[model samples]
Target: MIIDITCRTDRFNLSAVGPHFINDCCFGEDFSRWLVGALRRTGVDASVIGMEDFGWSNQATLDGTTYLVCVAGNSDALADNPDRGEWHVMLERKRSLMQRLTGEGKTSATDPLVRRIARVLMEAGLVEVGVEA
Candidate 1:
């Protein structure tokens, strides 16, 4: 299976650090590194696909994978795998449950995690960043 991990690539998509998941991470830089490492651990090949004003997409190429996993500014993980693999299932499941449940009992979370991840990717020398807000 394959998954896409997207995040807000916007250099000015910032808001108050609410008491939600959005407040936890905000496109810092550590998140992205974690992502790359996570995928690496799972034997997945992930590539950054640049960003728009406030969005970016990641390509997770797993074992013979050819699908997508898209995350957004305030979005979750999107895994598309024709042949669901065990590794993919576990990896995705962990992320889904952690992210969704972590922000429980709260309004919409403009998930800073994704953005923070983008920042991390930039610093890790994996993704080249133009500007940050």
Candidate 2:
């Protein structure tokens, strides 16, 4: 299965604080390390994708399946707006083997693996939304 994960934070803006604060925040170095570790524990080979305009991500693969886990600050401002808080996290599974086996259909957030990943993110205090099929 291919998992595409997007974590949106509430009132958090990594870009405004600059890279220096990355290691000092929850959605920073610690989160990245923790996520990669979690994936590894699940028997998935994972690696960091480094920083992005808003946050960062990690990539993983298991049984020839790919997983892209991303966390970013959401805002509509042309520039980084730490003041514009985020409200949700979105996770979608793409090119999934499960979908193929079950035939093309609506995405189900109740999938075991999806739940597992959601649990992991929740453990970090994120509010999950739009994860349901």
Candidate 3:
């Protein structure tokens, strides 16, 4: 399963004093940091991998299943106006080399927690959210 999210940058405020403080910890830096923090808060083992061309990446493991979260935004647009556009986010299962070679874990199983993660953002006032297989 792959969770896809598209939301405005202003919708997720990082400042606690901001009006959108309800989402202060929801999305940031393309959502890698936020996802890692959110997952950990939920008792899931998650860590940020590193930065990417348009955003950042992270890995989370739950019940022996690993997931890779990739987040990105329009650099040019953000550079011109920080809170002007939407950010794109995706969460997909990660498989080890053995699993890939053996054609296992090719598709992600429906994970309730993953849905919870998506729900959090949706309820936080995201512009759009979808789950893909």
- The model with the greatest TM-score is 3
lDDT score for candidate 1 against the true structure: 0.35
Q: Check candidate 2 and list the clashing pairs.
A: none
lDDT of 2: 0.54
lDDT of 1 by residue, 1-133 (tens): 2223333333322232324333332322223334656665545666554332323334555444222333333422324322111111101212345646676322111233333334554554542332222
Report the candidate with higher lDDT, 1 versus 2: 2
- What number of clashing residue pairs does each candidate have, in the order they appear? 14, 0, 0
Q: In model 2, how many backbone clashes occur?
A: 0
- TM for every model, in the order presented, reads 0.32, 0.50, 0.65
Residue-wise C-alpha lDDT for candidate 3, range 1-133, written one tens digit per residue: 4666555545443332334333333334536677678778877888888755445677878788777777765422455455555666677777788987887765443675567666666766765566555
Over 1-133, each residue of candidate 2 has an lDDT whose tens digit, in order, gives 3334445553444444554544433344445666678767877687787765446666766556465666544454435455444433233345667867877633355555566666666666765433533
What are the Cα lDDT values of the candidates? 0.35, 0.54, 0.62
**Could you give the candidate ranking by TM-score, starting with the highest?**
3, 2, 1
